[model samples]
Target: MKRSNAKIISTTFIILLSIFCFFKSTPVKADSLTAKYSMDIELNGAKKTLAGKENVSVHNSSGADLKELVFHLYPDLYNKRETMPFSYTNTKNVPLTEEEKGDISIEKVLINGEDTKFTEDNEILKINLEKNLKKNDNVNVSIQFSLKIPKGTSRLSYFNDVYSLADWYPVLSIYDLKENRWDETKFYPIGESNYSDVSEYDINIKVPKDFVVVSTGKEKEISSTDNKKVINLTAKNARDFIIMISPYFKCISKEIDGIKVNSYYLSTDDKSLVDIAQSVLDASVNAMKFFSQQFGKYPYDEFDIVESYYEGGAMEYPELIQMPKYVTSIEIQTPSTKRYIDAKPSIIQGAIHELCHQWWYVTVGNNEYKEPFLDESFATFFTAYYFEKCEGQYSPNAVLRSLRYSFSKLAEINPKILNLPCAGSSVDKFGNDKTSYVQAIYVRAPLILEDLRKMVGQDSFLKIMQTYFKEYKFKNSSIEGFLNIIEKQAGSKIRDYIGDEIYSGEYKAENLKPTDEEINQIKHETLKEKIKASEQANGSVLGSLLLRVENGEKAIIVKPSSLTKEEEAFVNSKLKSYFGNSYNKLSIQSDNSVTENELKNSNIVLIGNPWNNKIFSLMANNIPLSINKTRVFAQSFSENSDSVSGIFSAKNPKNDQNIMLAIFWTKDVSTDFYFDTYANPESIMIESQFILSIDNKRIETGKF
Candidate 1:
C-alpha cells in the first residue's frame, strides 16, 4: 500500500512541471519603432546621375492618429551654389563649379496605391496623407526620384572616378513626442543634420559590370546580366546607409572574431602606399577589438573602410566609412608630433576614428541634429583611447599632457569656449566659426569624459559605459539618458560636477598664460615685419641658425655640433609644429659653422646661453636686459626676474629683416626654458615652475 502512494505522488509532480513548461514557451512581444524600406536604383556613372524607386512601410506607434508624414530630401541642399553648405577648394573655400553642382527631383509619390500631394522645400519633404492613420496602423508610400551627383568632394559626390552616396534616399524623419510632430531640423554645413529612426532596408543596385561596390549592410548576392552588375543588400536597425563605387577598386579583407573587415582602395602602382593602406586596415581591426571590450560587443557582422575622394579626412556611416584618398597617397605625410610617432598604429588615426564611430554612432544611436557632441565627442575620446590603451602610443601621463595642451590652447585662443559646457552647448553656439565648434566638440568634450572617469573611478566608469551601450543600443540617446544611467551607477547626484564641466558657463583662467589671440597677433605682426623688411632684400631665403653647446674635457670650445638623438627628435617635432609644412624652409647650421655672411643675412636661433655658445655675447649689450650667474639685472627693461631662465629674441644688428632668438639659461637655474614664443622679441623669464615674467616695454607689449 505504501509503494502505491509513492508512485501517485511522483506522477503528480511531473504533471505540475509540464504545466509550467507550456506557459514558459509562449513568445513575448518586443516594443520598438519600425520602418521598412525597399529600393531599386540604377546608376548612370557617365552622366553622374541616379534614378531610384522606393517603397516605404511605416507603422504609427505614436498614441494619436497621424494625418501627415514627413521626410528629409537631403540631395536638394547640394544642388545650387547659393544653397551649398560647404566648398573645398582651399582654406578660403572656393565655390562649386558648374559641373560640380547637384540636384534632386521627385517624379511621383503614392500612398496606399493612390496619388498623394507632396511639397518639397530645402531638405524638407512633407506628404499629405488622404486618410487619417490611427495608432498602431500601417501605411505604405512609394517614391520615384532622380539625383544628379555632383563632381565635388563631399558626403555625396562623384570625384576622381569614385562615386559616394550618403543620404541619397527620401528617409522618414523621427516623430518628436514632445513636439507632437516630426523633427523639422534643416541641413547645416558644419555637422550632420539628419535625425532618423532605426529601420530595415532592402536595396537593389544596378551599375556597370566593371564597377566595384562598397556599401553599408550585409551583401546578399551579386549577379551580372546584360553587361550590368546587380547587387542586393539588407540591413536591420540602422540609422543611415552609404555606398562607394569605383571601377578601379582593389579590395582586400580580413576577419576578426567573426566580424569581416574589408578595405577597398583605388588600384595604384605605388606599393608603399598600398602597404600603408593595408596597415591602416589592420589598425582598424585592432580598434574594433579594443572598443568592443571597453564599451560592448559590435553587433554588425562586417565593417568596411573605403578610400575615396572627400574633403574631410574621413566620414563615418552605419557600417561603411569614407576616407580621403590622400590618406593613402604616396605624397601623404604625417605631422611630426610625439603622439604621432610613439603610436605608429595611429598613422591611420582617421581609420581608428571611424571604427570607434561604429560603436558610438551606428550601434548606440543619437540625434546628430540636436546633439552633435554625443557622436563626435565620443568618437574623438575613443580615438585618443585607442592611442593610449589599444595602440600603446601614449605614456601613463599622456592624458595629463594632452589635457594641459588642449586646455592651455583653448584658453588662449577663445576663452569663451571654456565657459560653455561640453554637454549643454548647441552647434549654433559656435555661430559661423567652425574651428571653435570643432575644438569644443572634439577636444573639450573628451576631457569632460576623462574628468567623469576620475570622479567615478575606472571600474565604475567602464561599467557605466557598458551599461549605456547595452541600454541605448539600436536606440536614440540624449544627454539626459547618459547622465541618468551614470548617476544610477555611481549612487550619487553628479549635478555639481556635471554643471561645472558640461553645463555651466563659468570658468577660472588665472593659472594659464599667453592667450592665443596675443600669440597670433604677434605672429601676424612679425610676418608682416619680415615682409616689409624683405621689400628690398636680395632674395626670399629668410633662413634660421641652430647652435648647441657640448662641454669638452679640457675647455669650453666652439665647433660644428651635430645634435644628439634626443635633441634631434625634439627639434624636429618642434620645428614641424611651429612651421607646419614649411619647416624645410628654415636653414639649420651650427654656431661655429655659420658664416659671417650668413649671420648678416639670416634669422638666428641660438640653442644655448652666452655662457656656452658665445654668439649671444655679440648681441648681449643690444638686448634690453641682461642676466648674470646670480640675478637678472636690466639695462633698459625691468620686471621681476629672480630664478629666471632667459629665452630672448632681438633684432639682428646687421639686417633688420633677420632676427635672433636665444634660448639661454643662467648658472643658478636648471629649468629647461623650452617654449614656442619666438614670434615676439620679448624676453620670457621663468622664475618658478609656472610663473612667467614678461617685461611690457621690451616687446612693445600693447602692440600685440
Candidate 2:
C-alpha cells in the first residue's frame, strides 16, 4: 500500500485547520459523580496500531469495600479463539488473514504508582487491589497498551486510511452491588459488546497531521508540529468515548438547538453524497430536538456522525455515531448498485435511529447484555415515529407498510420469534446470529412498543418515554424499572407487556383483531371475485393485463423487442400453458406505456420493481404489498442488488373492476427463469395466505 500526494497534502491542511477550530475548555461541575478518565494516544497509521496511555479515577459507590476493579478490553475480542466475539471478514465475505487479526498487548498497569498484576480471561482484565478500598473511596489506575488494528469490517478497525475506533480503549465495567461484583459481561458480537458507567473523559489524540478526527466530545484544543497533530477532546457523563480518523474525509458542521452537529464523509470527488449526508445531519438534528421534547432534554453539547466501515449499517456511541459508509457512497442520480444503497431513506433512517440512541442508550443507560430491548426497541420505534409523526415526511401508509413488511419477515423467518419475549433475553441467547437478534430486538421489539402505545394511547405513550428518560437519565435502567413507569402512567395495567413478552420469552400476541377497513376490504374482494366468476361462467370476456419489465426499470414497447430464445419460448409456450387460456385477452403493456384506461378495465400485470414502473413506484404502499427499489427484503430472506423474484397481486388503483398482477425479478435473472417460482404450486399456496398484519393486529390484504 502506498500513500498518495493528495493524502499528504490533506493531512497537512487538516492539522492547520484544527488549530483554528479549537475551542476553549469548560471546567467540570464539582458535585457530579467523580468517575473520570484522562487519556493520550498516538495513532500508528502506517502500522494500523495505536499506542496509548490511560488514567481512570473511580469512586467506590457500590457501598461495599472493593477488593478489585474490572475492565472490558473489547478490541482484544478479535483474538483467534473459538469463542472470540468477532470473525474478521473482508469485502469478499472471507475471513481475514492472520496478519489482519486484531490483538491488544497490555504493556503495563499501575495502581497508585506501583506496578500491579492483572488477570486476563475471555477479553476481560481484572486487577487485584493490595487492600480493600472502603466504600466512597476513590482509586486512580494507569495503563499503557499497544493495540494491533485489524483490517476488516469492525467497530474498531483501520482500513484504507480510515480508522473506526470504538470500544478501542479499556473501559471500566459497572459495579453491581446486588451481585457484589463488577458486571463483567462477555462480548457478544451480535449486539452491544460493552456496558459501563457514565463517566467524564479528557482525551488527547495525536494522529498523522492530515488525519481528520471525529470523536465523542467537544474539542478543547488542537496543535501541530511538523508531522503530527494533537487534539484534545472532553466528554462529560458519557458512557463511552470513540475516535474516528480518516484523511479522506470532508467535514461539515452546523448548530442545532444549542448543540453542535458535525457530519464527516469520505470525499468521492462528487458533492452529491456530501449533500445527502448534510441533509441526513439536518434530519438527525430535527430528530434530536423532537426526541428531546418528547423524551427529555439531551444532556450533551455536541454530536458527531462519521462515515466508517462496520459489519452493521451504523453503530451508536455516546455522542459519536459511526454511520456505515455504504449509505453515503451511493450514486445519487442513478443507483450504481441496487440494494442497501438507497441513499435518502437509508441515511435518514440510520441518522434518526442512531440519534435516538443518544437518548435511550447514552443518557438512559441500560445493561445492553441483559436487556437490549431497552435501547434497541426504543431506538427502532422512535425511528419510526420520527418518520411517521415528528418529521411529517414519510406518509403514515409508508410507515405502516414498512412495519408490516418487517412483521411478515419475522413471521417468515421463525414464527417462534414473534412469540418469544424480547425484554429479558440475555445477549448470549442471541448468540452470533445477527439476523435473529435484529429481528427480535429491532423489529419485534418495536412492534411490541407500538402495541403498548395503542393500548395506552398516543399522549400516554409519549409521556411514558419522557418519564422514562427523566427518571433514568445518566443511570442504568432495567426492564422492571421501565415497566413500573409505563404501568404507573397507564393506571389500569394488568399483564405487563415487557415483562411477559420480552423477559419471560413467552409472549404471544393477545386477541389479534382485524381493523374495520380490513374487514370491508375482504368483503369488497369477495364480491368482486364472485362477479368475475359469474362473468367467466356466462362466457363473457374476462379482461386481463400483462406488464413486462427488464432489470428493475420499465421497459417500453415502442417497437417489438426481443428476449433470449429461451425467454421467448417460456413466454409463448410454458407461460401460456400455465394460464390455459384463462383470460379472454391479456393486455400486454410496458411500464412506461401503460394507460389509465387499461388499468381501469383489465386485469393488469406488472413485471418489475417500482424503480422501473412509475405506476408501481407511486402506488406500491397503496397496494397490498410494498417494495423498496434497492432491495427486496423479507424476514427470512433479503436479496441485495434487487435480485429477488416474486409474484404478487394487489387491486388496480385505477379501477376496482381491474386486477393487477406483478412479477418482479432481479436484473441477473433470465426472463424465463425469473417467473419459474411463480409457476410452482407451493409458491401460489404461500402467496394465497396473505393475511397481513400490523403490530400483530391482523389485516385483510386484498386479492390481486
- Every candidate's lDDT: 0.65, 0.64
Q: Which ten residues in a row have the lowest lDDT in candidate 1?
A: 547-556
Considering only N, C-alpha and C atoms within 3 Å, which residue pairs clash in candidate 1? 79-102, 412-516, 421-502
List model 2 lDDT by residue over 261-335, tens digit each: 888877776666778778878887888888888877778888888877665677899898888764443442323
TM-score of each: 0.67, 0.68
Estimate the TM-score for candidate 1: 0.67
TM-score of 2: 0.68
Which structure among the candidates has the greatest TM-score?
2
lDDT at 167 for candidate 2? 80
Where in model 1 is the C-alpha error above 4 Å? 1-33, 82-95, 327-347, 391-398, 401-404, 420-422, 507-704
Which segments of model 2 are wrong by more than 4 Å?
1-34, 81-95, 327-341, 390-399, 412-414, 419-421, 492-498, 504-506, 510-704
Determine the backbone clash count of candidate 2.
12
